[model samples]
Target chain A: MNLIVAILSGAVVYAVSVLYAGIGETFTERSGVMNLGVEGIMLMGAMSGCVTAFHTRNLALAMLIVILTGAVLGLIFAFLTVTLQSDQTVCGMAMLILGTGLSGFLGEDIASKPINLKFTKIPLPVLSEIPIIGDILFNQNLLVYIMYLLLPLATFYIYKTRWGLKLRALGENPAVLDAAGENVFAMRYGYIVFGTTMMAISGAFVSLAQTNVWQEGMTAGKGWIAFALVAFSSWNPATLALGALLFGFISNLGSNLQIYLPGVPTEIFSAMPYVATIVVLIISTGNFRKKHTAEPAALAKAYDRESR
Target chain B: MSAMNKFRFEKREKQSALRTLIITAVSVLLALVCCGILIFSVGSKPLKVYETMLTQVFLSPTGIKNMLRSSLPLMFCGLGVALTFKMNLNNIGAEGQYAAGVIAGGAFVLFGPDIEGVPGMIITALCCFLGGAIWALICAIPKAYWGVNESITTLMMNYIALMILAYLCLGPWKMPRQNTGMTERIPRSMDIPEIMIGDIQISVGVFIGIIVAALIYCAYKYTTGGYQLTVISKSPKSAQYAGISIKKNILMVMSLSGGLAGLAGFMQYAGVAHRIVENMPNNAGYTAIVIAYLSRLNPFTVVVVSILFGGLQNSTAYVQSLGVPSQIATMMQGVIMIFVIAGDFFQRYRLVIAKEGKA
Candidate 1:
């Protein structure tokens, strides 16, 4: 039962983190831009959040700092890829290196230092009584509940709102939005900042909730999984949540199996998340091929309004 | 001056070549400044550190040899990456392929007889090359057939390779009766022989790397295959209309690229490290990617760039001797890569004020 509790705790945190990343990526992709810098953006957030938390020992303030730092990194990426019309791949790759270097260098002294936040956990008195489901859902950190709330909010924001429509329109055909007299760059920038901020929060969640101390390269390949989940869910927020949960489950399974199945090669088990990501990417791409649907027409293209 | 001449002032046409050169120069300058700041922050004189780094890499004979030795794997990995980039394929799996090559080469060393003379070395080299190419082909084939994103595939493969390497080090391949998680020393018979010139000992691996670079340069400069790849990269649609098979080309180039990286692993075992160890390439795979891009994916230029970076890597220990953390060097590499990439914006586009009615 305690093992189950441990597994559940890990899964909840993992799901929330991945959800933040996936939702953020969906926003960027909707603006007809692919920010491969999710990993980098996450690093920035993790560092900013961890450093703040380490010194102040305040979890809430640390979260705020991480979100703000994410916004700045996102804006920089947006300015480069959207405003400057640079290659998205190169920009993303550059940002990845920059983020990793910055975080590792800045966070070097405090990487393993313990600074517990004593994060608040929420539980329903009656709901917590239910056996399996109660432990899984009713008893989790406030962030987990917040993630659950944001899942629907994100879905509504993308599917129902006028701004969401405009964002999607850019992905499909920026010329249409341009013809409609919308400032495509500004619109894309808005989404990029929003998305980048979300990614940072996701990174911060790991440090603030799951563990108190920050480690170098701690995000591992979670950023990539978030990127992959965007496609796995076919860019739908609801589906994205499901995809993230599934990924979290796989991750949980890998770690859980580490103790139960001691005879198994832990190395192979350690590779589960990345392998699952590759499998998801391949499978999702295969589905796309089967459906014969094209990605957003303007995806990965930098629009130069003056070129014509 | 006539009124017509006065009004007909010619606008300067953007010189693409000049733009590229200027951006590269600016990026390099920025990188140096960043390194300078980092060194200064560490309470050391940046100039002194750089001098030590340079003198150790270029001025001393032993230093030059070490630089060349360190450069061997980088040369192969850089060239491999360059070849893939030339074809517009992102093969980020060189690190994985190198790991696989080590596994294959190590197996031969541990399992096969310590055959004497050049035959042993030749067989080992062939095995390593084939090992890398075969390992690389796994990803290439899936990417070609399934439309799988090679970037993710290659990146994931790196983890898988790392795990496999870990398993080998810790499991059945673990050194017999040894506490350390390393294979037994490879017999000297299976190793590449060191050459002596006067008082200097030159490893044959460096010679092989230089020869490979020369060969790659020739291929890129003169061969039809190279021209085909160049054409494909510039405009894939045109190549297809011209009857070139994109799938076949992708597979072929990726395999060749992987094979080159594998050869690095082979040489490392045969000439340099002489045994399979943990993190053998260290960050060489990633560093090679940066070097390949800095050289604009030109095979010949890649050779020059590799040496420059290899020198930096060789001088890292020397830089540490200056009381600065050697990790600063890695940070410098990352910073340089960022500036190099961001510098592309200035090369491809120029800022201009909006003309009348353009907005």
Candidate 2:
């Protein structure tokens, strides 16, 4: 029963974090920009959330502030890449370094000082008692629950809405969107800012609500995993959620199995998520090649109106 | 095609070189400004910190040796990273490859066939190179056959490799009865012998690095494979049409790249640390990437750039002696990378201010 609960909990956290980052990345990629800076942005957000919560002890406000901080940085990245037309890779890399360096420097100050910030936990009153399944699924933090709600809403918004249609069109061919009475640059900018903000919030969720402590390099490779999950899911928000859950399970399983399999060499188990990512990537891309799975056509390739 | 036309061509050449020089100067100045900001934050004079850093790296023979020793691995890693990068392949797994080398080299020292009073150093170094190259092949294989993105795959492999090293150091390979999470020291026979000229502790690794740099330069400039990579990077379709095998080149480039990084890994262990420990190589792979990119992927340039960065890093220890944080140098290194990437803009594209009528 405990093992089942652990698996469910692991899946939920993984799904939520992946969902947030995946949705946001989808928005950016859809607009013909790839934010390789996702990890860095998330790092900064994690630091901001931890530090804010440490000083103010207001978990809710800290979360809000961290998300907003992500939005602001995302806007800066968009401004450089979209407005100034800087090399997306270079700007993205710069944003990453800037985010990482600033956060690490700030984390030094936040460490050693304990805060009474609470980790997010289950809030459903009766649903928590349902069974082995309900106990695991329904008993996560309010923040994670919000992520569950956001996932379907994001899917609907991306696939159903007029704005979503314009966003996809912009990614496919910015000139067509520009000709069809929509501001291509503006839409791209909006998506980048919005996507990076969510990515940041996802990272902050780990530091503020999950761990409730500011650990240096604590996000580890979670950001990169989120980035890989985007590809594994093939640009679908819902499928990405599934992929994230799978990764989360892999990650949590390693930690949990430490006790059960003490002699198995903990480091080998620690490599599970990464090894899994590579395997998944190989499988997915291989499948794509085999079946001729059509990519978004303009994924990561910038569309220039004048050039076109 | 007259005399005036020739003068115009000469003028253009002078102007472009002048522009490059100015941009480089500004970037260095920006880096210094960042350093100054750090000094101020740490409650020290910027000039004093700079002076101490310079004196520490160049004035002291020990510091020079240390810098060269640190730079030896970087030289290889930088060249390897720069080589793949020229083909538009971002092989960020040099860190993993480096770690893999240490693990592979460590095996030789710990368990390799012991020949009668043999030079263990040569055997261990060869093992390090082979280990790094083989580990790099793991990343190369998938990229070659499976169409996998090498960047993320390599980066992910870094974590796995680090974990493996951690497991061995802390568990099965633990030095018997040691308090720390480190393997037992390799035998001194496996150590890279140092050449002492007065107070300097320069190892044979530096000499090897120079030779390797020269060889890599020759390979890139004169070899068909190097030319093929450059052509493929510019236009893969054209290369394919011209009958160059993409998969073969990818494998060869990645293997060679990994081999270089692996050698750096071995050098770090046999020359510097003398044992595989957690955090061995200490972000050297990552920083080497920055150096490689900054040098614009030229093998010869990688050597010059690595030495410069190495000097800056060496000076940091001196600056730290002034009661300031050692992390200040790392911050500076990060800032320099940003500027370096930004500098590429000036090289490739010229900024033009549009007039009011342009819109």
Candidate 3:
């Protein structure tokens, strides 16, 4: 019972980190823009957020810096893929390289140093006392709490509202939206910047809330896994949050299993998450499962109003 | 919104090679300037950093040799990446494939019969190629048959490959008496001879890379397989209509690409490291993507660009002495790739400034 509770609780820490990016990437993809550079942007956010916390010792300031860094990167991506008509894949790769290098170059001085003030787990007043479920779900940092709220809000925003319909239309066929007197270019830029900012916050979560120390290339394929989760969720924000926790549980199973099965090489356990990601990705996409995919119809295609 | 409307973009009818070259050059210069500013912002002298970086990488003997040495793997991986890229397939798992090659090739050297000279080299190369080809084929099946995204699957496989490598080094294959994750070194006979010119030694791997690139260049220009890939990439529907087996070609091309990257792992043992170690390829696989892009997927240009990019990586050590981070080279690569990607847009479209009333 103790071990099961321990595993379930430990899964939240892993799930929360990726949940931010997975949900963020879902939003970006839903808007018909594929941002493969989530890994890179997350690195930048980690660096800037770490540096900010070290200097100011203020979590709010660190988060602001993280969001700003993400915004600038998103603008660059939007300009390249949307305005300049560059290939989204190439541009995203460039963003990844740029983020990895730029963050490493700038964050060299601050790497590996722990910050004074990191986000601590805060139990809610009433919710914290509510049996086993509360212990596993509610006893998390501020970011986790925010995510709990953000996930549902995001789902409602993407599905239930008037703007949600427009957002969906922009992805399915921007021309149809344009024919309805809407600005496809401006809307893409908005959702892209907003989505990338979410990814940046995801990185800040790693540095400020989770690890409490800054490291180079620290997110360590969490961003990529988040990228996979976006697909696993079928591009739905609600399902994305759920998938993050499930993938988290699966990835953490390796580490937990190593305790019971000591003789087996740890690498086998460590590799479980990535191997599982591939299997899940294959299943979710098209083989031996439902042929359901929510991939945007106009995804990765540059919108040119002038061209037929 | 009104501000964005000030500029109009028109699609270019045809792409000009010279225009692309000029744009690429300008973008590189622009990225350099940005890096210079970044260096200055960090309290280091940008001019001093660049000067020492250039002198060390270009003029010093050790720097030049190191530059060439680094270029060896880049060339191999560059060729590998360029191959899949030409067919519009993104096989970013060269890092994992390189590891697979090393593990496979290293296993043969450790356990197989002790052969010497040319025959030894041939068998090692084949073993490495088979390893990479098989690893690539694992993911290719899903992509070819079921329309799975090759990019994500390949990237996911990289972590798994590294894990397998980690298991080998830390478990059964751990080097005797050393607590590190490294396999036993290959025999001295397996090492390729290096030609010494003055204080610099050039590994035969450089020549092999050039030869490989040349062979790839010829195959794409002259062979039926190359023509088929060209058709498949340009228009998949058209290729299907013409009876080109997309599934077979995807599997074949991906394995060939992985095999080339596998040879890069061979260069690690034969030319430099002499033992299969973790993080062997480093970011060479990732860097190869940028190199392939900058080279416009041309095999010949891939070599030249790899050497230059290799020099950039080599120069970082000199710059680091002056308080600049070694990551400056990596950062500069990101900047350069962004510029080149942006530069590609100019070739496809022409930007025009239009007055609002003109509409």
Candidate 4:
């Protein structure tokens, strides 16, 4: 019983980090832009968040810095892919390499040190007493709580709002949006910046809230996993949340199983999340019926108004 | 919005070779300027840093040898990446393929029959090539059959390959009496030979890489298969209309790409590391992507570009000596790529002042 609670709690922590990135990517893809630099951007966020928290001893300030860093990167991506009409995949690769290298170079001084400030878990009073559910969901850091609010709000905004319809329309058929006198470029830029900001905060959650220390490439491949989760969720915010939790559960299960099954190599467990991601990707995309899946039609393609 | 009306872009039908060269030079200069600003922020003189970097990487005997050594894997991986890029298949799984190559080559040396001399080298190389090709086929088969995105699948497979390698080195194949994750070294007899010219030693693997690059260049230029790949990359629908088999081409090109990358892993293991250590292929696969792009996917150009990139990599030690982080090389590579990609825009379109009647 104790071990179950521990695993559940660990799963939530893992879920929250990826959940932030998954949600952000969902928005970006919905706007018909595929940003493959999530891993590199997350590394930048981790390094920036750790450095700010270490220097200012202010978690709020660190969070803001991380978000700003993500926005700056998004601006560059938008200029290249949206404005200059460069290849999205190549641009994303460049961003990933740049972000990874810059983070390592800039964070070298503080890589060895731990931040003095960290986001502490704030347990709700009445919810804390609600059996197993309370301990796993309510006993998380402030970032998790923010995510809880953001997930539902994002779902509502994406489904119910006028802007959300326009965003989805842009991904499906930008020409149709253009025919309706909507600014395709501006809408894409807006969602892209917003999405990248969310991705950065996810990185901040890892360094400031989860680990409280900055390590080179600490985000590892979580950025890639987040990307896979976006595909698994089929571009829906609510389904994305669920997918994040599933991946988190699988990720935590690996470590937990390692303790119970000592004979098995830990590498197998470490690789579970990635293996699951690939399998899920193949299954989700393998279907021949285009109507069944929710992949953005314009995903990874450059939009040009004059070409058509 | 008002500022956007000042200029408009006009598409160029074709870019002259001289114009392409000039634009490329400008991109490199722009990238240097950006890095210079970064260096300035870090309190270092960019000119002095660059001079020392160049001198250490090209002028010194030790630097030249190290550059050649690093260039081997980059050349191999670059050639592999170039093949896929030519076919418009984004196969970023070179990293995984490289790891699989090391594992296969290592397995042959450790568990296979105790053969000596040239036949043993032949067997090990074949096994490594097969390992990489098989690893790549995991993604290739799916993509060819289902139209699945190879980029994400290939990237995800990298982690799986690395995990398999980690398991082997840490568990079953671990070197005796060592706590580290590394396999036993291959016998000296099985090691790839190196030629010493005066004081500098150059691995024969470098020559192999160049030979492979030349062969690929020939294949791309002179073969019917190459012409089919070009058509497919330009327009898959057109290729289908022309009766070119898209599935067969995807499988063929991807396998060749993977095979080349696997050979890179074999080179790293047999010529450089001599063991399947944890950090054996260290970002060579990723670096090769940059080399492939910078060289415009030309196999011969890949060789020249790989040498340049190899020199930058070898200069990490010199940069670290001046208190600059070695990651400066990585950062510079990224910056250069960004600028070059952005510059490619100018090759296709030219900016002109908008006419009064234009929107």
Candidate 5:
């Protein structure tokens, strides 16, 4: 593979992992529930996938385990923040800790060890042969292919449909949605679960598709980056997709550059993605020059039926 | 809804002090029970593990010293986090800020002039504080000025700070003739002294933590600046209406928070390790968040909770020999936090089952 194509292809592979979680968080924040436990949840999903693969050696079972783990966690989180009406930020932090702690405890035995299972790349027919573009985007795992459809489908789902409209309204004003005979609590619960399950898929991608190994807290700060990207892209799925790819390319560019410059400490390049997230977060949200943000008004606020 | 079982939660107008204490105590007890189950699941008898942990963490002289010794970083980090949290600024980057403090403090000890004893220690401490404050301000300025989410930005900065620390430890500052990832030890003149009380040794740094906590307590209870923080936390719009400078306070509180977290590095360096090392704070920064929240942002309570929580964190080392994973400490913190959050909700509201048909 040519160097440029390789980087682009690598970028796609990298972008898919975070994009799944990013888009998931987009849906979550859009529904007025901001989950800060993305890192923890991602770790748990990754751990569950690794454990299942090691024990069962069935990729299907591993994937199912990941989803089940995410569903259970997502339900607990929704119960705490939505039904219990706890502080979303604090609860989110607790969830993050809970996920990280649980995963770390459970996955301790597998640290630095191989799971002996991987999602092998399957290039699509004809599409994988289209000069440069095909190889860059088409030659990837099944999960990467799903992203191609997910991006547009999610954008259309949130913007073009009544359910999407209601989701947006739920974030902006749950009281208004409640007045319109909508099940505000149930809708929030549904989105929260869906978002968390998507985060699990993101984690499974890392363990089962990308690395094929289990490392404690191996998702690192990608979950945090996804959380920030929610605000960075101004809550637009299309823009968020582009931003994630840009991250993919820039982050890959660092490793590519390392081949030419060997004297600089490797940690600097490692820090690039995180530093970039901070910079991008500032650029997109910093209202510099009076740019408007499409933020959901009732975000992170608990809604009570009697209050309205 | 069935009339016989119909119930609703009603918020209390005021939560009494006794209720607050009861809620906290019950939550902690519940968390311990959950952790006991966790230990049992790992194949060890929960009773034996708890007995070992309780004795090792609190009973022995060395255990008492270690508990207070390990609590040093938590004291500073918890105080730091407690302050920013009071103003609703989620400065989760204290872990990174603590690293920045170590890096800066190390740089000074390696290159700066040698001054022995107390003044030198004070200067080094100040340097560490400045390092942490500067690291925190990176997120604070953007948050205060541009509405950037402080929580995410602070978190992202943790990786950045760790990278810089790793860069130094591996590249320029790597100790000569040693494979370990750390800088050289500080001069003996700069080391914080430990006084022996019978079989135990307590570093003066712990006193410094207590003093700092007391100072923060006074500021929070009596100062106009602290009053402004409460106003902003309650409602930014109302704070603005009342002419409180939210931006200035955000910058101030976050810097202080970061600086205090940075002081944790100083504790590890001068008081404990006497050398700058990688993973220095060891997640005391995150544990501090749980401590701060559980302590209810009270400085005096923060001191007490830091020791208890720090004991929980450090005591895992004792149980690792008994088939319990060291990560149990981290899990315990999470469990306790969840319980506390749930317990707080109960304290604020009560479910009243109403019999509408009978009435």
Candidate 6:
């Protein structure tokens, strides 16, 4: 029972971090922009958030700084990829390198010190009274509860809202969206910035809430896992949430197994999530039929008005 | 109508060499200025730091040797990356491939036959090449057959590769006398030979890297396979229409790329480190991507760019003396990449003022 509770709670915290990034990436991909710089953005967020929290001792201010940083970086990416029509893959790579380097350079001093302010688990009074599920859900940090709201809201926004329809349409066929007299470029810019802001928040959550300390490359490969989660979930926010949870569970299970089954190599456990991701990616993309797959048709292509 | 006219961008038929050089210089200059601002913000004198880096890296013999040593792996990895980039296959798995190579080549030195000299090195090189090729095939096969995103697959594989490398180093292959996460050192006979010119000593691996670059340049410019790769990269549909097999090309290019990266790892181990340890590759594979891009995937140009980047990396130690963090080098690399990528746009298209009645 204790193991089950531990696993469930661990999974939730882990899921919240990736879920934020997954949802952000889902939105960006839905608008046909694939930002491979999520890892770098997360690092930037973690560093900035930790530094802000270290000085000001305010969690909210740290998060706000993360969002602002994400917005600025996203704007730079959008300008290069969308406005200048540069190769998205190369641009994303450049962003990743830039983010990682800059964050490491800036966070050198703070990495050695731990921030005082960190997000603590906020238990809801009424919700905390429920059985196993309540403890797992309500006993999580504030961001976890926010994530619960975000998943459904994102779903409804993506499926039901007019803007959401246009966003999906932008990914599938930007020319059609342009023909409908909508500004495709502006929509992409907005989604990219909003999505990356979420990615930054996810990073902040890792350093400020999950670990409660600053470290270089603290996000590790969580951003990459989140990026993979977008594909694993087929660009659906609800599916992405479930995928994040599934990955988080696998991640938790590995660590738990390390404690319980001490004889087994820890490296095997460390390699599990990545190996599973590759297997899932293969299976998801292996299907022959196009209709079964929910990949954005114009995922990495630059929209050129003149070319069309 | 005149009032309504605005500036427009015109695609150039061809960007002249002089124009490209100018644009590249401007981009690099702009990146330096941006990095200078960052250095200033951190309360450091940017010019003093730059001067120290330049003198310590280029003006000193010891610095030049260190720079050349660092450039060896980068040149090899850069050429490897360039191979995949030529086919538009984003194989960011060079880091993993490098590790795989070290494992394969290092394993040969540690546990293989007690052979000595040229025969031993040849066998080690072959083993490393095969290891890298096989590691890269993990992603290439899926990408070729199922259209799996190579970028993500390759990136994920890197973690798995590193984990496996770590497991081996810390477990089975660990040196018997030490508890550190490192493997047994290779025998003295297995060490790669170095050449001495006056007071400077350079490894044979550097020459190998140059030879590989020249060979790749010839292959890319003058071979049928290169032509097929170019066609496939430009438009896979056209390549398919031309009876070129996309799957075969992907496997071929990816294998070659991985093999080269693996050779780089082998060089670093056999030529320099002489032991398999965690963090051996450091971020050479990632840095190689930047070198490949900055050189526009040209093999010869990759060699030149790698040397410059190598100098930047070597100067980190010198920069650290001025109270600047070593990460400043990495940050500068990132800045250079972003600026160069942005500058590439100008080479392809020229911004011009619109004239009345142009539309």
Q: Can you tell me the CAPRI class of model 5? A: medium
Which residue pairs in candidate 1 collide? none
Model 2 regions more than 4 Å off: A287-291, B1-18, B34-51, B115-119, B196-201, B314-326, B353-359
- Model 3, span A1-308: residue lDDT tens: 66776678778888889888888788788888899899999999989999888888788888999999999999999999888878888888888889999999999888888687898999988898888888888888999899889889989998999998899888889999999899889999999999789889999898888788888889888889899889888888877877778877887787888989988878887788888888888888855565656789988888887773
Pairwise DockQ winner, candidates 3 and 6: 6
Estimate, for each residue in B1-359, the C-alpha lDDT of model 2 and write its tens digit: 24333321111222365677578768878877876886677577888888777777866787788888878778889988888888877788888888888888888777878731236776776777787788778878888887787877888888888888877888778888787778777777766778987778778887787788788778767999868887899999999999999999988888888888988987888777888887786767777777776676777778877877777767766776576655564567666766655664566565444444442
DockQ of candidate 2?
A: 0.43
**lDDT of all predictions:** 0.79, 0.77, 0.86, 0.86, 0.88, 0.88
* Residue-level lDDT tens digits of model 5 in B1-359: 56535777878888798899998999999988998897787687888888898898878888888888889898899999999998888988889999999988888888888775788889889899999999999999999898888998899888888888877887788899988788888888778888998888887888888899999888877999878888898899999999999999999999999999889988988988888876687888888899999989988889888888767877889989988877888888898898898888888798787777643
A1-308 per-residue lDDT for model 5 (tens digits): 58899889889988899988898899999999989989888998999999889988899999899998988888888988888889999998998888888788888877778888888889899998999998998889999999999999999999999999999999999999888888888998988888888898899999899898988778988898888878888888998888888888888988888888988767778889998998988888887766656999888998887676
* Shift in Å, residue B3, candidate 6: 6.4
Model 1 lDDT per residue over B1-359, tens place: 24333332232366576678788989988988887886787588989988887787767778877776777788889889888878767787788888888888778877987775578777777777777888788778778887777876787777788779878987888888877667877778767666877766677876777788788878867998877777899999999999888888899999888888888887777777877887787767767777788888877677777767777877878877677654564567777877776777666655555444443
Off by over 4 Å in 6: A289-292, B1-4, B197-200, B356-359
For model 3, the local distance difference test gives 0.86
Q: Residue B124 of model 6: what lDDT?
A: 90
Candidate 3: lDDT of B92? 88
- Against the true two-chain complex, what DockQ does each candidate achieve? 0.50, 0.43, 0.75, 0.72, 0.79, 0.78
User: How do the predictions measure up, each by TM-score?
Assistant: 0.90, 0.91, 0.96, 0.96, 0.97, 0.97
Ten residues in sequence with the least summed lDDT for candidate 6 chain B: B1-10
- The better-scoring model by lDDT among 3 and 6 is 6
Q: Provide C-alpha RMSD values for all models, in order.
A: 4.1, 4.8, 1.9, 1.9, 1.5, 1.6
